[model samples]
Target: MIHAHLTEFHGLPVRYVDQEAGLTASQVAWRVQGDSYEEDEGTFADTFEQLLEWDDCDEVRALVVGTWGWAHNDDRADVPVRLLVEAAPRLPALEAIFLGDYVSEESEISWIGQADVTPLLTAYPRLKRLDVRGGDGLGLRPVVHTALETLRFESGGLPAAVVRAIGASSLPALRHLELWLGDEQYQGDSGPDDWAAILAGGGLPALTHLGLQDSVRQDDVAAAVATAPIVARLESLDLSMGVLTDAGAEALLSGQPLTHLKRLNLRHHYLSEEMAANVADGLRGVEVDLSDRQDPEDDWRYIEVSE
Candidate 1:
């Protein structure tokens, strides 16, 4: 679902330089096969090992993983996950990681196979940020982590289990959490009621920004979030990249006093012009995003990402 490739991660530039090109303190590079289907001379493991043995390996603090191999055969990132977990000791400076950073052209978000990243968290107890893009074969267990600050799952169809797993997990220092709940056809089966734990602010004490976006039943999500206990503490709320209508907007506008929020992002929606105007007019002090308005197809609303 991601169109653009990453230029930076964890406040460092992302590059594709070779070992011969040398590494700098301000940037991190990834070695990817030119073509997803091409048989690379060296596998991803080779590149990872090379990094571990690099003279400047200690300087590497963040990593951005791109194309792994021939994804047409459903190439999974399981090996990479294992490699990263095993290499945790060597990557002590590592604080952030973007697993599955490929764009749609390299691999469709839904088609990109991922694995249980729970072990990585346990291995890297100091890891503060993790951004994973893809849901196919993805896994997560509700494990408590004290240092994690941000966690994101970018998927076309985020499995319902993973959604609930995040809600059930205990993250005390988590400041921002973004979950893209793609279409059910791609595996995301979560509904409004599923967001209870997260919405209720069960275990997330430092959560200031929460995004439960790109859902099939966004109206219900909005309705649930309207009265959810989490909103009171969040400085920003993102309900974008889904099929939101006036009904959902009405619930948010009428329910809670959201004037305390600094930003309310509802981009890529199906809100009526009147409702859009109402949202802007209602949240005068709050920064409201009402861009990328879409027209329903034969009365059928479509989400931004549901592959």
Candidate 2:
């Protein structure tokens, strides 16, 4: 498993590979395009080959896979997944991967195409962390892994079936889980009930950090999370970048005993300053983030990433 060293990248904490210390973190990075594909930079396969060529191959731990395409039209989903499959056998020390690093300018989070990621998990038994963006055609059927500790799926409109698959998975060592259930407007079909099932299920016995972020139905989610049995074991809870309002915050403040949490993120909300402060006060010792206050006049609410 990778021991991620915290480093700032584009204002966020990411993991950068450190050969000397055998430490790595996920950082902002982009793979070069294939030479035959109009851009003569480099292909994902080529970059991976370079990584394999290093003398300290056994020391490398983390990788942030990105694309060089300028627009949606230039994105090629097949090559990346194929190259990853080809490279997995040789990446013995690899433990963490952040697939699809494109931002809104390159492609919306929902627009980025993704292949089934189950094979990667099966190939690497030591893998501990996996972060995937874009949910189109994404599937992980009944995965039963041992070393996996953190799993994050950042998508706008995550399908209900995928949510069901996650709830049914057998990852006993998983400690962190985050799912961005976007608006139904973008194909996000998982409703409050789907989330309730995930929370109620005992699939992830080791889970502590939970993030149900970037949803149009955030208030409903917050209301559900307030009473979910999973909250009792969580050390961190993130419900940011959505339509969280005063009512939802009130549910959290009034219902759950958030004193055990180490961190609580409630950024990008529709809460008034008074309400934000009130919620912050409720979780006295917890590190709380209530930034990016939204005005009610902004009639329509949106998730951070949507196609």
Top TM-score prediction, candidate number: 1
Candidate 1 runs further than 4 Å off: 17-22, 25-36, 296-298
Which residue pairs show collisions in model 1? 156-182
Clashes of each: 1, 5
Candidate 2: tens digits of C-alpha lDDT, residues 194-265: 786678758888999989988888888899988999889989999998899888988888786989999999
- What lDDT tens digits, residue by residue, belong to model 1 across residues 1-307? 3898888788777766364375563366443323446565667777677777777676677888777875547788888888898888787888888898878777778888898989988998888999999999999999899999999999888888887888899999999999998888899888876788889888899999999999878888899999999999999999999989889999999999999999999999988888899999999999999999987443887788876
lDDT top scorer: 1
Whole-structure CA lDDT of model 1: 0.84
lDDT of model 2 at position 168: 82
Q: Residue 42 deviation, candidate 2, in Å?
A: 3.5
